[model samples]
Target chain A: MPQGQPLTVPNDGLTTKARRNAPLLAVHTGPGKGKSTAAFGMALRAWNQGFDIAVFQFVKSAKWKVGEESAFRELGKLHDEHGVGGPVQWHKMGSGWSWTRKQGSEVDHAETARDGWAEISRRIAEERHDFYVLDEFTYPLKWGWISVHEVVEVLGNRGGNQHVVITGRDAPQELIEAADLVTEMTKVKHPMDAGRKGQRGIEW
Target chain B: MPQGQPLTVPNDGLTTKARRNAPLLAVHTGPGKGKSTAAFGMALRAWNQGFDIAVFQFVKSAKWKVGEESAFRELGKLHDEHGVGGPVQWHKMGSGWSWTRKQGSEVDHAETARDGWAEISRRIAEERHDFYVLDEFTYPLKWGWISVHEVVEVLGNRGGNQHVVITGRDAPQELIEAADLVTEMTKVKHPMDAGRKGQRGIEW
Candidate 1:
C-alpha cells in the first residue's frame, strides 16, 4: 500500500483463487542464477506434500554434479527406506540418453531432443508425475531441436492437476505465452563482473 | 557455440575461481516469485557441505509454515541425531520480532526492523554462521526501516568466509551496488493473471 493509493478490485480476476485449480506451466528463464534452484525448491515443497516428483535436465552435463541433484537423490532414498515422502525421479542431460560432441552430429542431437520432448509430452498426457521440473529445457527449444509449437499444444491440453516448471535462458515466446507463470532472472551485478569464480558446496 | 562463431575467452573472471573467499553480499530482488525459495536452496547446499546455516525471514507471516523452513528444520534435527550434515537455525519475521498490524506504530515497526538487522549485523561481524539467508530483507531496507548505508558498509568490511544472501522485491540501489551478486526476478506472467489463488504446499 503506497501513499494515497486507491486499490480497486479487478472484476476480471482477483487472485481471490487460482484459475480453476488447473495445472500450472511455469518457466524460469534468464542470465541470472537460481532458476533451477527455485524449481528444485518447488520440487522439495511438492515432495513434502506427498507429490511424486520428476526432474529432467536438458543442458547441464552429467559430469557436473549439482547439489540439488544430490539432495533430491538422498530424499528419494529416504522415501524408499522410511516412507517419508513420495517417489522421485531425476534424469540429467547425459543420464538416460544424450548427444555429446564425440557421439553425434547436430542433426542427431536434434532428433534426441525431439525424442525427449515426445516422452515428456506423453508423461504429461498420462499424468506421470505430480510435479515436473524441466530444468534447462530452453536450449533444445531455442536450437530448433524441438518444436515450441508442439510443446505449447501438448502442455495446454495435458489435462491434470500436475505442475510443470521449465528453466533456462531464451525461453521461446510461444512457451511463455502458454505458461501460467514465467520468471525472467535479470542480472544487475555479479561477482564474475568483478573477477570471481564459483566455489564448491556453494555452486553445486 | 553459435553458428560458425569463434569462441573467445573473456578477459573478465570466468568464475574460474572466487575471491580469497571473502564474505559474499548477495541480493535476490524483483517482482517475481522464488527470491526467498532460491536463497533457501542455497542454504540447503551449505547445510549439505557441513556449513552452519542461519535463515532469518523478514516478511512471510508467522502463521505461514514455509516448506523450506520445515525441510531445513528436519535437516537440523538429523544433524543433531545422526550428524548428517550441519546445524541449522531458522527465524521468521514474527518468530524473533514482528510488525503485525495489531502490534504497534509504523515507527515501532521501523525500530523493530532496525533491531532485527542489528542482530544480524552483529552475527555477521562475529561469523556466527557459515552461510546466512536473510529472506525478504530488502523490504525493510526499501521501507526505510533499516539504513542501507549501514548494511552496505558492514557487509563491505565484514571479513570472513561466510556467505550472505538477501532477498525481496525492490532492493535499494546502494545495497545492490555493494552486493557481490544481485539478481532481479522479472515477472513475465503469473497465475493471478488468470484469477488464481495461492495453492496449498505451492504458495507455502
Candidate 2:
C-alpha cells in the first residue's frame, strides 16, 4: 500500500541460490578422531543427491589393509555400473613409512607430496567430478613436504561450481579462514586413548 | 711368488663399491613440447647440488599467457634465487587457469592436476628423493585417472637413492617396471616447427 517505497524481493529464493553455490567446507581438528568418517558421511549424502564424487586418499597406499579401500573398490564397481560422468578415483602416495624410517631426512618427501597433489589438482581442474575429498592431506604439508602457498593457490582458484572437502588434523589458520564452513572434530573420548589400540572396521 | 693356485686377496684399493650414484633424470613430454625445458634447463639445474630436487609439469596454466599473468607474477622472484629448491616448483601449478573467450571443456584442463599427483603414492611410501621429477604426466591417464595400483604400490616401491625421474606423455602403463632410470618424451616438430613461437626465459 506504500506508493513511493521500493519493492522488496523475497529472500527465500536468494538463500536457496546461495546454498547451491556454497564454498567448500574444510574439516579439521585434533588427531585420533573421526574427521574422515564425518566426511565420508557427507560424501554418501552428496552421492545420494546424484552428484559425482571423487575421493583422493593422499597418504594411503593401495594395499587394502583397511576396509575403506575395499569399500572404495566396490564403489568403483558401482560407478562403472551407473555410468557416472566421473568415476570415483583414489590416489595413494606409494612410499610407506619404512623408507623414511631408514633414511631420515635424505629423501625428497616434498616431491612425492607434489606428485600426489598433482593428481588431485588435475581432477579438480578438469571438473572430473562435482565433489572431491582430499583425505589426510594436511599432514604432508605440516611435515614440510609440500608448499603451503601452492596448496592455498589451488584451493583458492578452484572453479566455483565444484565442491571440495579436505579432512585432516591441525589445519592451518589460513585454510580455516578461507573455508565457507569449518568443522572441528574434537575427540571427547576414544578407545585408542585407553591403550586398546585401533581395531578393525570401526577404527578404520 | 708363483705357487700352484694362490694369490693372496688384496684389500689394498680394489673395492667394488666405489662407484658414484647416478644422477636422476626425469623428462616431461606430451602433445605440447618443452617438458624438459621446464624441468631441467629452467628449474632443476639451477638449484644448488646439495639441495634436493623434484620436477613435475604437464600442460601449463594460462598464467603463462603473456599479458594475463607471467611466471614472475605467479612464482615471484624465486627463480632468480639459488637457495630456493628449483624452477620446476613454479611449474607445479600456478593459480590455475582463467577461462577465456573460448568455451572449452573444464573437464580437461590443467587446474586440478597438481592435486591429483602432488602427493604421489610412490613418494609417500618411499620418501626417497634428493631429487624427483614427474614430467608430462597428463596424457596417457587423461581419460582414466591412473589407478591406485600404478601410482601408489608400484612406483612407490623404488629404491631410496638420491634422485628419481618420471617423464612421459600420459603416464599410464604397468608403471610397475622398476626404474633406476626412466625417460618418456615423444619426438616431433612443433610450431616453433613453423617459428610462430619461441622459448621464453621463463616458460622454456
Model 1 agreement with the true structure over A2-102: per-residue lDDT tens digits:
11112443466434443435577899998887888788887887777778899887753553336777777766766787777668898765533432333
lDDT against the true structure, per candidate, is 0.74, 0.44
lDDT of 2 by residue, B23-45 (tens): 23233323322233323322222
**Candidate 2 regions off by >4 Å?**
A1-15, A60-65, A82-86, A96-107, B1-204
lDDT of 1 at B67: 72
Per-model chain B TM-scores are: 0.84, 0.27
Displacement of the residue A75 alpha carbon in candidate 2, Å: 2.4
Give the candidate number with the greatest lDDT. 1
Q: Cα lDDT for residue A74, model 1?
A: 68
Q: What are the per-candidate TM-scores when only chain A is compared?
A: 0.84, 0.76
Tell me how candidate 2 scores on lDDT.
Answer: 0.44
Docking class of 2: incorrect
**For model 1 chain B, where is the 10-residue window of minimal lDDT?**
B1-10
